[model samples]
Target: MANVQVGNGVHRKHAKNQRSPEESVTEHESTSMGSDYELNGSTNTEVQTDKYGFIGGAQQTPGEIDDVPPDVLRQREVKWLEMLNSWDKWMAKKHKKVKLRCQKGIPPSLRGRAWLYLSGGKVKKEQNQGKFQELDNQPGDPKWLEVIEKDLHRQFPFHEMFVARGGHGQQDLFRVLKAYTLHRPEEGYCQAQAPIAAVLLMHMPAEDAFWGLVQICEKYLPGYYSAGLEAIQLDGEILFALLKRVSPMAHRHLKKYKIDPILYMTEWFMCAFSRTLPWASVLRVWDMFFCEGVKIIFRVGLVLLKCMLGSPEKLKACQGLYETMEHLRSVEPRYMQEAFLVQEVIDLPLSERDIEKEHLSQLRRWKEARGELHCKSPPRMHGAKAIMAAEPPSRQDLQQNPTIIVEASQGHDSNIENGKRAKKSKTEKNKDPNSSGLLNPYPLATDQSQGLLKEGTLQGSNQSLSSAEHDTYL
Candidate 1:
């Protein structure tokens, strides 16, 4: 047997004290847990492994097994495979069904592929074919690379993949984070991203993981991993405000103790609960998070507070800030079980509309208290489905439509054909007062043009504004 250090600093001996001849020859084969364990000589010790490959006593923690019936899992896998094959149609016509399925759970076998599809990582990879390779080929900035190297061992260290120092798991994690720094030098790297990227690597390959991290940092949660983390701070305020309605008792307790939401929630929200929730619940929450967006995160937080501190009896142990923080950090296992947490998140009344309304209110309050925000990038489209919905018409679709207007942003002269100005005939120009030598047959009335522009209908052919932008067009 060989001693192996698993995640969280626990050490376990190999399963068998002596390897058979066949076992020795096939030792390098990948396991169902998605990692290859290397043997280091032999000893007489033995230990058991969990379904997820956590060894020894670490298996006592929750989420160690697949609780779903084999038949149910098979059926869900079939449905998910069908949805993935006709993803565009499902997203366009049967989104509710997709949401319902994601809420129930994504099959373990299909989770990696599903996450790539749901995060629009697949689409992003398609758009920028060789971008990750380009970034990977270059040596990353020393500032970020140095910090990233230090944090690599700390991410899921007990997991089989990352257990060995400089192992493939840590190596892939390094590539993803280092590539990100080169991709967006200004933002650099955030320590919080390491664990998030580690979770992605567990499911997908390194290239897919890089794009998934890109979608997460840039699209799913804009401005979140920035230098000051101003966006997450703003979201903390929004979460607290929403807590008042979800659990007034919990709100009162925090307010009475003067406990800032950021103190407890920074890790939870920043890592999307990867460090806080059990392994199974984290996957379930992430399935919904990548499908629906950050609202799922908010709901999970609100549910935790409501379950842990919503009542006077529950709050008895949480008499002060220290106790409250301690309780939050070491949450009782019962409160974090996948079935319970998923149902609570699903039943919660929180919606994206509610989050946005509170976001605006918080923004106004922040400006009043501390002037303008540093990061003004507009909010991103929520979820993988929203990203897919906002995708511009495909090149083939554009090529088929000859009369479509050329967007000015694409370095095209909107009014020119070939190398010359496309002038309208004098008779036609005089017949339609609103005509501007474009393809629009139903030209807007003089008074309607400004309103139409304000409404965003006049932006451009290729522009794909988010639903929020459409709702708040000005």
Candidate 2:
């Protein structure tokens, strides 16, 4: 049975009996055994044992983790030390190798720091040292407080840290989320932000977690958690396009029932697969996701679709969207293993170039359809349900109503925006700003130019993806 650690107390139910005192957890390793890190504010190191003498808690027992041969452990330790000692060099010049290293997995002891580096959180934390506290000290928007409060315990209820109603985990979750609301009032607080914050808190301290969340929301997945969720909708369409090519049988079967990707994929994309994949797999996905870009997500999604309903027989069984969702969510744990699923993701033929090309193609269609936004009932694509509840405007809307797009694009702070665009040449200023790579299609609700708003938006297409069998030519 799983052992439940309730703060300072260890509650053992169905697990094995306690170990011999000689074999009891050591003072140094007890707290850090599970999750590769101690839960914030947890001080008790005594691990309770079940009837079978097995240790239990939110994580695997020490013996289970120690099952790895000492030689392998030592080798990993050496690699971890090498990574820590030469972090800057790895990040700057040898990032491709760093990606390969991450694919193997980051040492639990070093995962926090590695994630910080991967997400650029270390620099972000330094730049915004007191910002979180400043935001915390101020009163939060009344509108979002209740939502945050309601969603606190929902984050990681089974985990010891967040199990209690007013525990440190939930408190930190609130502070991090609330600070984000204060930091970016326009986006306010979205329910999806809670899980991401909760996952960050699980691995790092509150302040560090806060900055990581900031990097994720503002930098990693721009426009993702905003009120409209335009990015999710756009990506849903992109996924549909990819599905048609990757798994035509599954794609067509779903379309036969008019089952849309949005119905099942919204939460998957919104939470970065945090809620969809198991904890172990989720961490592995994060390891790669931070190293690469959102391409990891698309690839993972493809693998999931292929696994869930790639065959005609399986797809035929799903009578409707609801059934399709159930089948998708019910994928076996064995197949979703971190190593196996990640290897499949790596082997996937999909590429960022594919997603970028699809995104541009879809954006052009959306741009053509902007005049229909006021129709109050946006036309569904091929009779599929709308992924974005708030329909995005067409490109014509940007040309005709430039001010709306300009104002909507201003939600982010100027410094944050500068970080996104970097430097421009004097000669570049003479050219049309709209024609610049800076403008891209965002969603209609954002009323902002979304086509090329960020540096990462179009750059993914240029990167080379190595296929499992061969290098892809894009």
Candidate 3:
């Protein structure tokens, strides 16, 4: 059984014997806990044997099993429950306090709900009820199905949630991935998305998990999991640039070895440290990431680099990318603890502004180097649904939809060929703005169109058409 040691902490098996770095690397390599750690341990009765004859579980309550002390766990539960109740007030008025609380750590008991709120999963889940089931009922793309199935057992195989081939955990994981395939057909399924969605499932229901996966893909880390993973490649350059400023010697040493940031940071950033950090650290990092955005990830990466290979001697000791990667993968449990790592990440001077500045600069450099077009940044996903609902559609979109703006165009005497004027009745004039065709130009209005979006039924519809053409757009 492989065990992790950190900061002179006791060596303990990770639920089941955790796989070593070598095993993970050789195995096509992949990749939690109860409420405390969002772990899903099985009772002894349910433990199943894999082909290798590895068994998982203990006699105690499966969800209650955790490494955190009982008092600490209780305290966190109480604190988080209070915050969860006043979530809206705190988020809107006491945001700094919220960030502080998140930096401390979200209580495991409330982590699922907290994450749902932080990632705006509730709105999305509500907007897409039954969609996951619809997608699941259909046979998925065979290529993605094969890849997802192969990676299922590879991720958190020791945990009860995903230990068996067809357990609820694995089943939920499948539904979430399938829903994402349905959600963003352009990107389809990426190997990296599985670990992320699996972690979300450990805390929330499958429906919530699906939305959280959507939030992560579209909001938190856009382009990171896309077809070419272009954002990830760009961030690799960004990470190296940041590394040079924070730890020049280590940066130079890695450069000397021709060890690219992709060799290490791909799994680190794409998996959001799920594959690199201990389970506890992964949870803590996620708590901050959900609250603080992607900057937390960069800060955590910097801190890990500084801790493991900050010293010239240590950097010199690593002969190649494999050694550097093994060193990172084998982080000591002591330093990897939530209390320790979270504080270090917080103390680091890395800021959102810094990350944004660096990202723009790096993106420009990348575009110039590759002669690629500079596409507009992805739409801001922070409270996106609510924001879209509150705001009116752009004039351009209103013009595009001839049905909604027919009278407006006539009043303006605009040269819109094939457009006809339609008069509104008193009842139409008194109708709500959303129902008066004003909001229909953009499909974000609350209506059946969002449901069509949820089920991916409108995949073939022309986006330029008016809201009347579809029930709504998301």
Q: Scored by Cα lDDT, where does model 3 land? A: 0.62
Residue-level lDDT tens digits of model 3 in 58-170: 21122322456756754565555455545565565777877787877776556777777777766565555577667756666767766776777676766645655444456
RMSD of each: 17.8, 19.1, 17.9
Worst 10 residues of 2 by lDDT: 465-474
- TM-score of each candidate structure, all chains considered together: 0.74, 0.66, 0.66
Number of the candidate with higher lDDT, 2 or 3: 3
lDDT of 2 by residue, 1-474 (tens): 444343333222211211211122343333223421243334554445422122433322233322336456435644654554445555556667777877776655456656765676665655555776677677678788778888876775655456545444555677788888888887889999998988777667667788788777765576777655666777788898888898888788778778777888888887989877756677778888877767788888888888788886776668787788778878766567677899998888875567678977887776687522221222222100111112222222211111112232444335455553533532454554434333322222221123222322223221111111110000
Clashes per candidate (backbone, < 3 Å): 3, 22, 11
- Model 3 earns a TM-score of 0.66
- Per-residue lDDT value at 139 in model 3: 66
Worst 10 residues of 1 by lDDT: 465-474
- Steric clash pairs (candidate 1): 1-43, 6-158, 7-158
How does residue 81 of candidate 2 score in lDDT? 46
Mark the 10 consecutive residues where model 3 has the least summed lDDT.
5-14
* Best-first order by lDDT: 1, 3, 2
lDDT of 3 at 396: 32
